[model samples]
Target: MTHPLTSLSGKKGLIVGIANRHSIAYGCARVLKAQGAELAVTYLNAKAEPFVRPLADELDASLVLPLDVEKPGELETVFDAIREQWGRLDFVVHSIAYCPLEDLHGRVVDCSLEGFQQAMRVSCYSLIEMARLAEPLMKDGGTLVAMSYYGAEKVVENYNIMGPVKAALESTVRYLAHELGSQGIRVHAVSPGPLKTRAASGIAHFDALIDAAIERAPQNRLVDIDEVGATCAFLVSDAARALTGDTLYVDAGFHIMG
Candidate 1:
């Protein structure tokens, strides 16, 4: 077998949203670290730190910080630590999204004003926030990638208000790519098919969504976290330098179905 390092060795990156070993962020971090990219990871809080800290250690992360995006100044603290430690960053992976249970399980039309706003702030605006901080630090040019989903394009049953939230996130990806392209910064959204992630567990009837994806996708199988990770590594690697302002699907052909 050919050893494909994807040429990311020595690249430094910050990964947000790693909850546990099963997180998509963890998967991406795993492959990126394997490709010899140095990593910095985050935990949402003290409780989550217990679950995420060991994985950060296993990945040999140079910096591990608390990062609750909604918490005032916490995001800045993480970036500050990155700046103090690495001086410059080559890439960043943003894989966080959230909505209140009441809003997530309800119809989009019925979603509360506060709930919708909160979801947009967390799931959509946070990318813009991160991109702003990363722009200057990406001095040598870099890539920024975020987690998105098929629900952003088409209505998936039980996805509820997140459909619109993801739609906004995808749009932000394009706008950020345009703004940052001249600086040699690439921005993209990686949309993977349904998986039993901690985030996905919040969706109502998520198991059925996964089953339908497996049955209807061209490959007739579900995508694993490692696959998602490898795709993320590709987007940030030199291999994908020319690629930006687009949503890359790693869904085993599920999105192509009419």
Candidate 2:
């Protein structure tokens, strides 16, 4: 047996937003699965299945699901499947975020109404939706985590509308923590330094961001998904019972720089 502070053996968790091998969600899923947690993992759509299924099979995930949170009835279907299979949820890792290409490239002020609304709904509101749906399933109390970026706090060029969107997501984490605390539920925002993930490809000049993170971070290096996953594993473990509504930076001290 492993250390209880980090052992998730026999626990159950849902992992969303794994687009491919390089995804941060994939990293989190890998670590959780390694710790013996049974996982319920999602792919964005049919085109994504080939990539995700292999990983799920590798992890021995209990359920490999199609979870387009934007699609009608889709989110409910996933939760329904989870209820039918495990009947309880011990943790969740939410790493999905979306923004239209134009809005992502444009100034925040120029973001279209539709794009802004869609971004908020998918990136921020989805976390709230998951927390509400998981509350009852977490009868013994559990942990909920979502991915965030430094963009949520400070101005990061080319981050554009996502800056505000992530800000909203971080704030939602706090409110959910407060509302769910009595039940022993914990909520957190894990902000990682920029990496070369498929999702990061959406941002213009992301290479620059990656380079900047390394150059400025005290460690003089970038963080990998495994590093981020290690922290996620800890946060969901019983050892982190006293922590809630906080943002955990797995950014290699990048946030400490000017």
Candidate 3:
């Protein structure tokens, strides 16, 4: 089927949290590039520099910067760079979330207060920060998209702290959508089923979890990153203009059955 949205030929987008080829954010970047949007990218630190620099080069991104969301100044720096370079941004993709592996594997009741706060900071607060920073630069109005997981809705095994974080992230999507709607900006989240990613693999029993999703899901298989990317493109495009304050699932039809 022909894609309903206009090609993002002249659009400039900021993509955060691409770790490697396996990351969903990377998939989003690839598709967005193919769709002709100019992009800017960021990685967490020097450790990921070697991995992401080549990919940013491949996309011919306008800027590649280091960001540690926990760093109070980094968010402003990144957005300032975007303002300086692009002057205005058409869209942003937020694929960042983090929680201690131990905290995610343990019971929620046992989660450390520090761990909970850290999770909320990285996984939830970053979106709020991004929205606040991006709202001004989207002078003509734009889209902000984030990646979430089914764990936010149904408690999957060992997805402890992140479940709550994703839940809050989803809520942020709606609240931001309402607040930004006046400005014509759309805010939304994409919830995908379990897949093998560096981050997802941190969970205990991750393979069994993927296999379980495959077995029980209506599609009888795991979701793919490119599929998620395509859906993201739709969300950021004009065809989805009426959609906002929503969490759209790109999970291989897996989320509906069980």
Most accurate candidate by TM-score: 2
Worst 10-residue lDDT window for candidate 3 reads 1-10
Q: What count of clashes does model 3 give?
A: 0
How well is each residue in 70-187 modelled by candidate 2, as lDDT tens digits? 9989999999999999999999999999999999999998999999999999999999999999999999999999999999999999999999999999999999999999999999
Candidate 1 lDDT by residue in tens digits, 1-258: 314537688799999989988899999999999888999999999999999999999999999999989999999999999999989999999999999999999998899999999999989999999999999999989999999999999999999999999999999999999999999999999999998889999999888998899999999999999999999998888888788988999999999999
What C-alpha root-mean-square deviation, in Å, does candidate 1 show against the real structure?
1.3
Q: Kindly indicate the candidate among 1 and 2 with the higher TM-score.
A: 2
Candidate 3 Cα RMSD (Å):
1.3
Off by over 4 Å in 1: 1-5
Each candidate's TM vs. the true structure?
A: 0.98, 0.99, 0.97
Q: At residue 182, what lDDT does model 2 achieve?
A: 98
Question: How many clashes does each candidate structure show, in the order listed?
Answer: 0, 0, 0
Query: Each prediction's Cα lDDT score?
Result: 0.93, 0.94, 0.89
Among all windows of 10 consecutive residues in model 2, the one with the lowest summed lDDT is 1-10
Descending-lDDT candidate ranking: 2, 1, 3
